[model samples]
Target: MATSEKQVMVVGFDDHEHSAYALEWTLKHFFAPFTSNPPFKLVIVHAKPSPPSVAIPEASEILRYTEADLKKIAARVAESVEEICRNKLENEAIVEVMQGDPRNVLCDAVEKHQASVLVVGCHGYGAIKRAVIGSVSDYCAHHAHCSIMIVKKPKTKH
Candidate 1:
């Protein structure tokens, strides 16, 4: 009764400095004294790109390369990444790897997990360039089902 309920905050992570910055930013801002709760739990989510449509020419007749096969490989990679991240992060988190368009994949994860917040990082693209090329953070900001936090600062290593 004293501690209140805990919600889930889905954080988009790709094992890079930008994404790491977002995670750290959220932790610093939401959690206090580096060890307090923020009314939510951090859930690390990564959207693995869909497998190329190229078929295994030799195995096409029997067992052809399918999206599921590629997903299996991607899952392994995601698992490895999750292990490293979990070991490095100070707070507890959950890891989820999904497939398809990154924008839709991330949004879907938010809805599926019923997350209360989606923390993402700005890719540092200029407005003109972002308008032309598009940005994942932009897409998430517009489409995420929950509250979105876009960390714009670059990671600084001292």
Candidate 2:
């Protein structure tokens, strides 16, 4: 039996600091083929909120925003990733944004894209808060089908 080729998809939001760090992380860590090799796809996911005017709608309603806006946000996030990649890996990378839960959506993308690795960032809420609210990274780490990388942001100096 032969090993299948590997692909990577990184998931996160462009608005959050931790997500930005996560993007930086994927660029630094998830190295696929560079020269004459299968390209790795970077996925930056943002959950657009449902508009308030309309009555509560189905899950699909959550992603009602324009694709242009979504792609622009994803591009900005990817630019950060690209900067990190150029400095560290000496290469540019491909990036995309898909809407949904950061965990479920990412895992789904991994399955759809047949990605071997999934990288995401963990934003640490206090233990009490996390116990009640749950964290996206924690969920992904436990449930994702692919090899998962959970990036953590460093503590800020007071």
Candidate 3:
């Protein structure tokens, strides 16, 4: 089947264990049976913070350093994602690194790809922390224009 003809599944990813576990779980449950051709095309989306814009002479140097650091982080994220999906998927997963809040970036990716499902990892934050930091999964669940799946990492027994 043609790549464009297949349904798209957008997975929100980052350098976090929660997201990694979500991707692993997704593959094991949804894509394991069909090694040759999965039902949906996987697209991993990573959202990086936009660099601050300041109008100070000294800030330019800082901006340059920050931009370089961000680039390194993006590269590391792409490598990690590739490694995670290397053996699990027959078709290479599309990786997108966008600048913005994760909630907005993920929803935008879903729209851009015309995805049928949006998968995100739950941070399992408490009410206070969620209110303060803002839960990306919660925001996507409410705002995204498709089915949303928030995967929670299973608690390990000590």
Q: Top lDDT: which candidate number?
A: 3
Which of the two, 2 or 3, has more lDDT?
3
Task: Give the deviation of candidate 1 from the true structure as CA RMSD.
Answer: 4.4
- Model 3: residues with Cα > 4 Å off, grouped in runs: 1-4
lDDT score for residue 148 of model 2: 76
- Tens digits of per-residue lDDT for model 1, 1-158: 13476788888876466776776677667764446445677777877777555466775544445666767766765676566555555566777787787788889988988888888877798899999988888898888878888888754699
Cα lDDT of model 2 by residue, 3-119, tens digit = 564455656555678877877666555543353353565555554422344555674455455545665666676566566556755444555555655657766766777766677
Choose the strongest candidate by TM-score: 3
Instruction: Tell me the TM-score of model 2.
Output: 0.64
TM-scores vs. true structure, each candidate: 0.72, 0.64, 0.94
Q: What is the TM-score of candidate 3? A: 0.94
For model 2, state the Cα shift of residue 156 in Å.
2.6
Runs of candidate 2 with Cα error greater than 4 angstroms are 1-4, 30-44, 47-53, 56-92
CA lDDT of each prediction against the hidden true structure: 0.74, 0.63, 0.91
Order the numbered candidates by lDDT, best leading: 3, 1, 2
Report the Cα lDDT for candidate 2. 0.63
